[model samples]
Target: MSKIRGMRRYGFLASSIGVTCAAGLALVPGVLAGAAAAAAPAAPATTAGAAPATGPVTGPAAVPGSTQSLPLAPRAAGRTRGRAVGAALEQGLRRADVRHFSLVGVVWDNPATELHGSVQIRTRSAATGTWSDWQDVDTHNTDHGADPGTAERTGGHIRGATAPLWVGDSDGVDLRVRADTGDRTDDTAAEPPVPLPSGLRLELVDPGDTPGEDGPQTDQPRTGDLSEAATAASAANSGLAPLGATEIPALDRADTERELLDLRGDELTDAQRAEPHIGARPRIVTRRGWGADESLRSPGFVYTKKAKAAFVHHTATGNNYRCSQTPSVIRSIYRYHVKSMGWRDIGYNFLVDKCGTVYEGRAGGVAKAVLGAHTMGFNSNSVGIAVIGTYSRSKPSSAAVKAVARLAAWKLGLYGMNPRGKTYLKSGGGNLYGKGKNVHLNVISGHRDGFATDCPGRKLYAKLGTIRSTAARYQGR
Candidate 1:
């Protein structure tokens, strides 16, 4: 799957689920937030007696990583190329010099609306002073979000967005987005170019400084008072590790069962208790280990009834980063999701760097059934694991694939699930299954299995059989 072929193959089914879309990124509280308050600036709290937005604003400005939202306007009518029918919502060759940023994406007013178009960007390297070729931003990204009709989906301020593209450290950029209004050329035709979604804004994300910048350790200690949300995130893993532990140590199979039985003994069946098939617990760096600004996400953790499946994904934020910068890259994506894309948190449940190091994602206990905003219609009752690179044409590193298996084996095992088996998950709405419908899926499936999009990418998707076999072996199946 060459990148070009991959882009050409990204066609959606006629009946994919859609949701309400809103624009802007203001900080709000409750089940889902920011929509009704998009007009407010991210910082300098004006919430009537609120204490001057001091530390780690989930609102953007208070954090080290920031998002620059530049509005997209209509291009001049005189432009000769890029009109599908008539001059639709086309941002033609807009260039700007801005603060340093490494990742970029485009967001629109409504989540239900699809940008049946093309998005391309080229950037001037901050270090090299040279321009890179135009890279296409994947348009088929609506599949990577919350299920339709959920509070997280309907939550105010949610917007339609393309996948964020990692461009490495760059200061100057050129952006262009054109809607595919079909191939009608006549200006007098009744149909117009399918206009791009409303409130379209180009978002450039600065992942911020290294973790050690403000502390002696890479797992920078939380600064200032912790938000109730951050506290809850830490408390979720109370029995697994000491309070405020930066990483959870791995345990052998026996110790893993002991810990699991200690934490959730009451729920295990007699058979499961007698013969636990759970794999050895793998070491996982916590959000704290990676210096996550916990306050950046809205103050709540949503969980499914029980986790039954693991959906694999690729960050699609590009492969320009090194393994050492994984934390920074994750932070940038976190900021982009919460502050830029208007979500409750970073979408994935866990993230794996190319070197196979796994990091906790979506601020919840690693062993819990934490709900994630990944896999769209299939988010409920499933875990999402995203490798930190685009894999359309590129082969996923062997280590990354193995990491997925190891994480899946232990996570699914917690619920007595067999990684190599099949499970039924009711559809929340997607091209493959409509809302409230039951659909059978492999216990370990790719993102595309739940929605019509090329995710986890082709190379990684192809490695699922291997991942499943490896995970099953780990569980002694």
Candidate 2:
């Protein structure tokens, strides 16, 4: 079977990041404020109306890595009144040229609110200056985030969002959001069209220039001494890589076992130390390699006691990126998740591109149990691995799936977890499980296995069993 839409194309220019919130549909420089301050509540908007279909929030020369947030308003096309559609209105942004952004998503106020509608975008390729056909953006992506009551979720800044689409470096975009009209239980009255969420804003993200392409390499990321925050982030991974190493090089099985013994230290018993069953460490591009603007994340790192399970996810940002431009896609998401969604950092622990290149996600060391906001209720004691594109209607590449298997085998093996086995993860409270519930789950589970929503998608989820078997083999089980 072929994908409903073949590999989508997304390219972007990373320059400067911007700030955005539910209340204020404005994009400011990411460097203008601290993460905490950036996440602070925004003053309420005095009025409710769509912003003019202006292109970028700023001028043509937007802050390098940029985000163009435009509010959506009702359009006259396809709208109906008089019970059949209940004053139904279509919200959209007419074709317009603005900034150089590669990724796009629609966001709205209220995390609990769902957009009962369709979101489609047609973009003009920045390189060719030709418009592509309209592409559907996943509307049910709220299921891919943090669970209820968590600080990340409870934070006043969080908002409901559609799955972002990676549309390559595009200077122009056209969007349409039409509400769904559900089947009526009875014919008594015409079913009113479902309402779109409040405060819908279209987000255009430019990942900015690739690190080495326009600036210093990751080994020496900047001209001057590194910032205190940047140093700390690098130092956290010092156990595995050099202080400023761009990547953690792959380690053979023997070295990996030695590394395991060294990393586990007092945690390992004499027997375990002698025969530390662990898989070889895969090469991982560090945050620096991907040009993560360290200051963009909240200060400090959060970690769980240890990783017990691995929850797989798809970024749902579409399949329109080449393996080479994956870094830009990640940087774009980093800015979007932090600056736009008001999170401390990007939500996943690790990101695997379609080509199987794994990038370190969330600042903490790759070996440590870095807490992630990826899976809502079951984040604790688990590692979140996000494959780079949407897998709902498409199949993940063989390399991507293999990378997940390799990552899970190594990470889970650190905590003595059996990839082919099962474990229990307490729900912080989610749609599927109640708080503190020790839910039995596979050592490697799809996001939807823990949450009720369709995550990791049906196609990707179907491969979980294969991934488990493969990982177990890698662990030499």
Candidate 3:
């Protein structure tokens, strides 16, 4: 008679079956004789009167309609209704503010009696304060039914409803039950609980608004405006046609009568017959004076009275003695430039050979000359011209760079200079010439800006921008 007086006599006969089943059928046999006199068992009745136990003892039954009692064995009333349905699903997953979760297994549905499962939650990122990890799930309640009969009615109603199978990085686990009375318990279920595991109902999402395919995309162009628009679309598709001052070529009269009949006499000298003569004198003498034993007659041409332009120098040496190949090897380089560098005959005012011949140096006409070496504080109103050899490491021939670009566009249109805003020498120090100063020659330059060596190296100073774009397409700019 005791199991707490048989659960208070089946909780007062289930509170009098709604007032004795509303007084009918003679009050159901006086409410089964007042539930058999309230489970009559005056203590001494273990064996002497075991027959006294009647209604209240329907094999530990009571809940036909309520004050919960049924626990004699449907596996101890499914382990007391799985610990009151796992304490009402851990108080409804702690009122649904679920924490890091994972369950993944539960699904009852016995034809829509519903009970779902499957968890994988991850929260805790109040703005990247970090947490989220193992995500992936299913059974989020498509009317919760067959997932092994909702994990055997959530392991017979829920108490530690057999969860743990989330294999990685182990966390607070414990669920993996099959218990529909097959009793198995690893128990540890109480903290902040609830019926959560239903893919923990997703909602936090914002790892920078998550859409990934590995992120970032846009930026690339400046290599100097893509090499100046590929050098102005390769100089407007280069078929080359622009120089128009009526295409200026003329000057031949039999090569100026065989270059003034190879300048008559003891191979000339006397400062090569005192300079002056230019274009029509191909027996070329090109003098360099003032050192035949010094004496340009006392500062005779010390920078020819402060010259203003002309500073070109290019004899990167190497002459394999073919001195223009022969006329007695060009008179032994005209007596080794009138006896060894002590000039007076070859300080170039024009030389160009490797077969694009144009010799007469230190002469005059190429807009008047005055040979005083090439550049160095504007070598006496300059006029150097030399193309004897060593174009830094070979590259002249295209008919000797187009006959030195047609004698530097006909001597920069006979020196009214301004080959694109001049300015030549640059190791600092200002104007000895004009436009951007320091030896401006209005056209050609190089010899490493007037000496201190490397005479025209990087392959003819990389063709000085194609000889200043062929003297700016022959000054038509």
Off by more than 4 A, model 2: 1-63, 77-88, 183-191, 212-225
How would you encode candidate 1's per-residue C-alpha lDDT over 331-441 as one tens digit per residue?
Answer: 888888888777888999999989998888987568777778899788888899999999998999999988889999898887888999999998988888899999999
User: Tens digit of lDDT per residue, candidate 3, span 198-246?
Assistant: 2111111111111112211112111121122122211111111110000
Kindly give the number of clashing pairs for every candidate.
Answer: 4, 17, 24
TM-score preference between candidates 1 and 3, better one: 1
Q: Which of the two, 2 or 3, has more lDDT?
A: 2
Model 3, stretches more than 4 Å misplaced?
1-246, 253-376, 384-391, 401-450, 458-477
- CA RMSD, predictions in order: 11.7, 12.8, 53.1
Which candidate, 2 or 3, has the higher TM-score? 2
Global CA lDDT computed for model 1: 0.74
